[model samples]
Target: MHKSRTNFVFGEGDKNASLLLIGEAPGAQEDLEGRPFVGRSGKLLDKILKAIDRDRFNDTYICNILKCRPPENRNPSLSEIDECKPYLNHQIKLINPKLIVTLGLVAASTLLGKDSSLKDMRNNIFYYMNYPVLVTYHPAFLLRSPSFKRNAWEDFKRIRDYIKD
Candidate 1:
């Protein structure tokens, strides 16, 4: 399904970062640039991180659940997610971050292994491979639903509270 993808988008940031952020998949800008979260959503993410006094490149590592862009930028199917799981898992193992944050439903469900609503997942800490995991609205979702920015801010604050530096 991702055969036409231009880049693998294997992810980027400090390998030793204590924070690992996972999104659903690469979008158009991310695919073209071969970097995760480099589009409008990324810009918003930067602001979000800045609000909590975090930096994308220097502080937290960022990547997507699926490294490649799905066709038509559509949601990734189950088979595709299954195929990409190993790579993401390896990343998690290598990063060994103290905290893991899933930015959307796909990523959260992938880690938590449940189909709960983002609403249900928020403010709750789940575990992935012994690391604490948090779930929040994707930057894309926050952009579309500005009202939820408050909720996202709360989630980010939770992160800020944990990684006090």
Candidate 2:
């Protein structure tokens, strides 16, 4: 996969952050820059964090389930996810965040192993390897469906509350 890509976005942010955000996979801009959440979605994410009084740079460890981007920004295959999960798990272990937030259905499904709709998943707390997981709408989704912004904000407030605890 590395042969087909420009860079490996292993993720970035505070190593000791108490909050960790996991997305589905890297997008084109993220792949081009070898950085997580650096595109328009990322900018929206920044604003979302600010609304909750959190910062990705100083407070949260932001990463994706698959470090490498899929060809054409397609959804990841099961094999790809299987191959990449260990790396993500290793990162989670190292960060040991108090809460793990999954942005969008793919992420929530991948980690929580639930096929429930995003609406059903939102605001509900699940567990992955003993870490608490909260499901929410992705920033990109919020960009497309502006109505969901309120829901995402609510989820972030829940995230803030968890970190506070």
Candidate 3:
């Protein structure tokens, strides 16, 4: 199913790494660029990653739940997520990361098997497929709600702590 959608980005890191970042489907910019986190939200995400001392182009492997961009930047439907999930599962298995960081509600809800606000999701570590998973607010959400950034900073600090130790 994902084969026909050429816009999706997929892969593990180039070498041994223990952390994986999974996001929701691509946006228009990401679809066009063939990379995850390449637009405005991506810019903010880069800042956040830098704050935590992690870089997507180097230490972290990034991918989406769905490879293709949904029409009009809308949320991907249940069937889309269901169809593309196996690929994500496979990537996780291959990477064998010690930790998985799920960005935003849709990605976290799908991976963690629960529907909740980012507020409810952050600051705690969960488990998925036996790997430690951390949940955090999406950069887009922080763009909309700048007041929440301090909270996100705390969450990123937690991730750094885990990665460092």
Q: What TM-score does candidate 1 reach?
A: 0.97
TM-score to true structure, per model: 0.97, 0.97, 0.91
Please tell me which predicted candidate would have the highest lDDT against the true structure: 1
Query: Tens-digit lDDT track for model 1 on 25-50?
Result: 99999999999999999999999988
The residue-level lDDT of candidate 2 at 112 comes to 88
Q: Which of candidates 1 and 3 is the stronger one according to lDDT?
A: 1
Minimum summed lDDT over a 10-residue window in model 3 is located at 8-17
Per-residue alpha-carbon lDDT of candidate 3 for residues 1-165, written as tens digits (9 for 90 to 100): 444455656643433466788888887788777888888988998888888877776677878898888877789899999998888888888888778999889999999998778788787889998999999888888899999899889988888889888
lDDT of 3: 0.82
- Which ranges of candidate 1 are over 4 A from the true structure? none
- Better-scoring candidate (TM-score), 1 or 3: 1
User: Which model, 1 or 2, shows the larger lDDT?
Assistant: 1
